[model samples]
Target: MSQALAHNIIAEADYLATEERASVRHELVGGEMHAMAGASERHNRIAGNIFFHLRAATRSKTCRAFMADMKLRLGQGALFYYPDAMLVCDPTDDHPHYKQAPCFIAEVLSPATAKIDVREKWSSYQTLPGLRYYLLVDAERLWAKCYSTNATGQWFEQELSAEDRLEIDCGDAHITLTLNDIYEDTGLLL
Candidate 1:
C-alpha cells in the first residue's frame, strides 16, 4: 500500500530502532520515513493466500517464505519496504530486521498503491540481482501480472486471469500457483 511521509528525515539506524518499537510499520526511503497504512479485507486475503501457498511450497526446503512483517532492505539500507509476500533462499542474505535477497516477491495491489507497486516498487525490485520473479495481484478481481527473469536474465511479463497459473522457478524447485489459489476465500469470481 502507498504511504505518507512522516515528519523530518532521520538516520537509517534511528529509523530501524524506531521501527523495532513502534506499533505502526513504516518504510524508509532515502532516510525519510513513510508511515504505511492498513490494508483492506480483500487485500489481506490476497496477501495471505500468496503467503500460504509460498510457505507450503517452501516447507522442508532451503528457501523460506515471509509475509508482511518482514522488511526488504534495498539500495544499501537507504530504502526499506514491507512486501506482501516474499521468498528468500540465500542463507547469507539474512539480517535480523531485514532481508537483502529475495528470489520472489508478491504484492496485492490496492487502488491507493497500484501505481507505486507497478512503477516505483517494480523499478527498485528489478535492481536486486537475486530477485527473479515479481507478482502483482489485483485485490478487486481475479487478475494478476507476473514478471519473471529467464536464464539469460531477461525479464518477461505475463498476465493471468482466473484460468491461468503462475509458475515460479526457485532454483532448487518450481512452484505453480493458480488464480483459484490466489483468490481463494476472497469471494472474487474466477
Candidate 2:
C-alpha cells in the first residue's frame, strides 16, 4: 500500500536484515521492499482501540493482541507486513521477531493504502491457514469491512456501518465490538 523502496527486488534476508537497522517500518511483498508510510492520527487511534478491545477479550485465555510495531510473516510467500493489529491464540507462535499464527488481523485504511489493502493484501491474507477473520477499517468514516471464514474454511465478507457491532467467533474466545469501540476518541466521526 505504501511506496516501494525501489523497483528492484530485495532478497528476503536483506529485507529482514535492513528492516532491523532502519528507523521506519517496511513490508516485503513478492521480494520487493516497500517502505511503510506513517499512519495518520486517526489510523493509529483506531488500531489502538481494536488492540485494546481484543487484548481485553483474550485476557483470560492464552491469546494475545499486538499493534502495528509487530511484524507478521505470510506463510510460504516470503512476504512480511505490519497489520494494524492482530490477535493470536497460539502459544507456539512465539517468534523472535515476527508472528505466523494470528487468527485475526485488522487493517485501518488510509487513502494511500486502501486500494492495495482491499485487493492485493486481501487476496494474500485469504490464503492463510486458520485465519479466522480480516477487518478493514475506515479512517475517515464510520465503516468497516469484515472478511471472515466459516468452520468449513469458506470466506465471506460483511460491511458494518455506524454503531454496528462485529461479532468475532473464534470458538473458545469471542469478541464483539461496535463502531463506538473503535472510533470513540479518534474524532473521525466528527
TM-score of 1: 0.93
The candidate that wins on TM-score is 1
Q: 1-190, model 1: which lDDT tens digit per residue?
A: 9999666878879989999999999999877888999999999999999999888888888898999999999998889999999999998876888999999999999998899899999999999998999999999877899999987899999998767778887856567898888888999956
Per-model TM-score, in order, reads 0.93, 0.90
Give candidate 1 regions above 4 Å deviation.
1-7
Model 2 agreement with the true structure over 1-190: per-residue lDDT tens digits: 7975657778777887898899989999988888899988889899999999998898778887889988888855378989999888888989867888889999999999999889988888887797899999999888888998888988898898775779986636789988888788987652
Q: In candidate 1, what residue range of length 10 has the lowest lDDT sum?
A: 165-174
The reply for model 2, stretches above 4 Å from the true place, is 1-7, 75-77
Score candidate 2 by lDDT. 0.86
The candidate maximizing lDDT is 1
CA lDDT, candidate 1, residue 148: 92
Can you list the residue pairs that collide in candidate 2? none
